[model samples]
Target: MSSTLLAPVLEREEYIEQAYFFRTLAERLREGVPAQMALLQIRDELLTTTRLPWAVEFLATELKHSGQLGSGMKRLIHYFTPFQAFVMTKAEEEGVRFSLDHALKVLEGEARYRSENPTPAGLFVYEFEVLARCQLGYQNGLDCMEQDSFFDEDWRQFIETVRRSMSEVEFADLIYLYSEQYIQDQQRAGREGPFPRPLFGLKEGRIAKASHGRDPLYLFAALQRQLGYPEVPRLRLPTEQRGVLQMLEHKVRELELRLRLLEGEVRGQVEVIQALGKPETAESSLEWLKRLDNEE
Candidate 1:
């Protein structure tokens, strides 16, 4: 494993700026802005004192050259975490339905949480929930997470154990076993052998115990409710849903345009040939709509 996961080296301001960077990038992409142009524009908006602007500049340059932001992020190991790079790489992979925009939102949430002074348990649960909900591979995802500098040695070991035994174990049970509540219960039952060091506290233990045998998402939710852990952003709509939404939006736009054309013709201010000759982005009513028939 790369030693880049040792400990968070960036300042609080860096994380704050990173959160903004990711958020703005994701938003721009959603608004139909090109990635390289969005990166350049956002670079000017970041705090000049922070390193994020320089990093964004580098990402833009890399994207211009290699047509990939993940490649640049991977090369900037000193600035970006391995998990961040891993997420980007996964998002950029061919045949993966996960889009780069969705990955940016995920990073935005993580960076925002980090800027708020996150605890190891909270970060672990947040990152794990991201992987679980996003359908990112648990084995590789947990491996990258285990190396995060935010986690101590014990946390790393526990994550490694989870990565290996996740198939055989219920996630909630694992949390319950390594928690202080488990030790207390064992002592009360007159069982006195060596016990693993508690990584999760009493609150987590209780929540996990209550959540055992249920969906792991319930365990995550219970922890979030009781502990104020950072919430993982939900995944983007599935491909089929997105396609249906796009079709509906296209239909709505077409209807609006047709209504505008009818009104223009009734007023004797427009002709079919003139309207069709105008660019899709013409300042007329068509400006608000794409050529609905254009292929994506």
Candidate 2:
């Protein structure tokens, strides 16, 4: 929690533009756009004279030299939060299976939440899920999260607690222990010292209590179902995206062949007797292409 690393809570409009940047960049990257080009392309789409577009321009230049967007973002500590840069670095790590597209989507969702004045409970749950579901190490991940300006000293201490004990402790128990319900119970029991304000809401406490010892994902689902917390983005396989593109290409080729057949008929290249020999059926147009191949 170095003061040097913590950025101010950004303006709501800035977060709105940031969400757009992440979503547009992730979408273009899937279409084979280069990282530097993606940043460059998104500049005009952002609001004029804003710091985000300038950050994007610098990111584009830094990406050219270091071949890592994380390095550039890290340098702009005043604009991009440390946690933001950390995610980008993890996504770019060598020999890692984590996806950059998934990371970007996670960032976009976070920015959208921040634009709406996110609560600490909502932000914490959403970010913790990103680390857990993606298998990102809790130590460094919590270290980065603690540096975010949205959380104060109490949050930093709680995060440290979770960081040290997460391997052995149930996550729901931890949330319940730090919630407002816990503090209210303490007061009812006649504890006299001034108790610290709770970090989690009463509803969060209830969900955590119900989910104790169950799969922690069930807790996350409860939170999202009862509350409007943002859901964690699951990692989508690149091969699945490629398969979809291939399917679309196959359909396009089928249509092209059908068009060529119509053109042949107009040119009198098709024999009327041969055309009448094999009538059209409900089979795929690909089957029609196969029949045409056999005729030749």
TM-score of each: 0.79, 0.78
lDDT value for candidate 2?
0.83
lDDT of every predicted structure (CA atoms): 0.83, 0.83
The residue pairs found clashing in candidate 1 are: none
Candidate 1 structure quality by residue, lDDT tens digits, 120-182: 888899889988888889988887787677788888889999988888999999999999999
lDDT of 1: 0.83
Of candidate 2, the 10-residue stretch with the lowest lDDT total is 276-285
- Runs in model 1 deviating more than 4 A are 1-7, 236-296
